[model samples]
Target: MKIATYNVNGVNARLPVLLRWLELAQPDVVCLQELKARDERFPEQAFHDLGYDAVWNGQKSWNGVAILSRVGEIHETRRGLPADPDRTQSRYIEAAVQGVLIACLYLPNGNPRPGPRFEYKLRWFERLEAHLGTLVSLDAPVVIAGDFNVMPTDIDVYVPDRWRDDALFAPEVRAAYARLLKQGWIDALRELHPGQHIYTFWKYWRRSFERDAGLRIDHLLLNPLAARRLKAAEVDRRPRGWDKTSDHAPVWIELSDKPVRARTRKDASSHR
Candidate 1:
């Protein structure tokens, strides 16, 4: 199955662009972040018309996540991070679709580091790490995809030196990302094309995309079982050049049926 993730920046603002990409990519499942809309205002009917079942967690004007699956039978597992007591932002959502556990996330940007926002970013990573630890115990094919707002390596950015002080490339942020991968989750894009300077996000200002200056902040992370089935992974950068486009483009991964074998074995062992 083909699974993809994209940070549309704002669901309302980029619906047209999103529709075009959806038609082009035609993924089996899609995870969206930065919806910037309220739950009531989400354009569910549009997705419904395309034969997709959508589960959305949205707030007003910022930080929302949603999943759309053409395969139908979407079962929402959770909405928002558990450890967060405030539950003020709609930044995380998880669902089971087509036998795969999918998570959509919009991690905090945490710009202008060495401050409260940065601290919050680190704390958020810790919470996410803890959550992922629990997910691994399920022994299912799982994928966590979103705009993580992190550059996992220097090769991920166009000019690594230019982003040294930015929150996305800071050592602390990279370490947090490393910790996530250390939990047996594979970075799908990197796995497909190692040591490649590929980017999925580019700033609108300063002709970033025109100059091929971008950062690989968006990602599709797969668990060990899921990784075993990964067939292909890529960033669809062409969509970002379209009119009224989001700063981010779609990143996707294709998985074969190998993971089902591992899942079945684990299930059998548990029953013993």
Candidate 2:
């Protein structure tokens, strides 16, 4: 199966570009972020017409997430992160598509740090860590894919020093992400193309795309069960150059069909 993630920026504003990319890329499952629309405002019909069934958690003019499936129905598992009861931002959504547990997320961009927004961003990471702890206990094949809004390493960004103080490259943010990786989730793209400077997002200002000034903030993190089946991972940078396109491009991963056997009671008992 092929799964992809793209931060569309604004579903309505970039509808045409999104449609064209959907046709060209044709990912079997897609995780979209930054819808910037309310639930009622989501253009379900447009995606439906393209043979995709979508479930979205949205809010007006800001963060939102959605999962689109082509093979079967998308069953909503969760609407938002349960760890933060006060989190009203529509930045996350989880669903089951073709037996795979998928999480679509749009992490906060805590710019102009040392303020309330930055504090919120750190607190959000704490919530995400808590959610991940629960997810690991399930031991199910899970895929967390989205625009993380974080530059994971120097290799993930065009110039690490230039973005030192930027929200995406913050040290604390990077440490939080590292903790997530330590929990056994594999970074699919990095694993596939080790040491490659592949980027999924570029700033619109200063001809960032043209100059190849980009960052690999978007990602696909898979549990061990899913990681074992990962066949390939790539970023479709061409879409970013398209007319009225999103600042981000689609990051996709292909997985093998080898069924992941569930751990037996005996196996679980042995671990204890």
Off by over 4 Å in 2: 259-272
Question: How many clashes show up per model?
Answer: 0, 0
The stretch of ten residues in a row with the least summed lDDT in candidate 1 is 261-270
For residues 1-272, write the lDDT of model 1, one tens digit per residue.
89999999899899999988888889999999999999999999988887788999999999999999997689999998887865988889999987899999999999879899898988888899999877754668899999999999999989789889999999999999998876667798887799889999989999999998999999998877787788899989888999999999899999997753234443344324
Candidate 2 lDDT by residue in tens digits, 108-150: 8988787888888888889998897677435567899999889
* Residue runs of model 1 more than 4 Å from their true location after superposition: 259-272
Model 1 Cα displacement at 101 (Å)?
Answer: 0.5
Best-fitting candidate, measured by lDDT?
A: 1
Q: What is the lDDT of residue 166 in candidate 2?
A: 85
After the best TM-score superposition of candidate 1, give how far the Cα of residue 164 lies from its true spot, in angstroms: 1.3
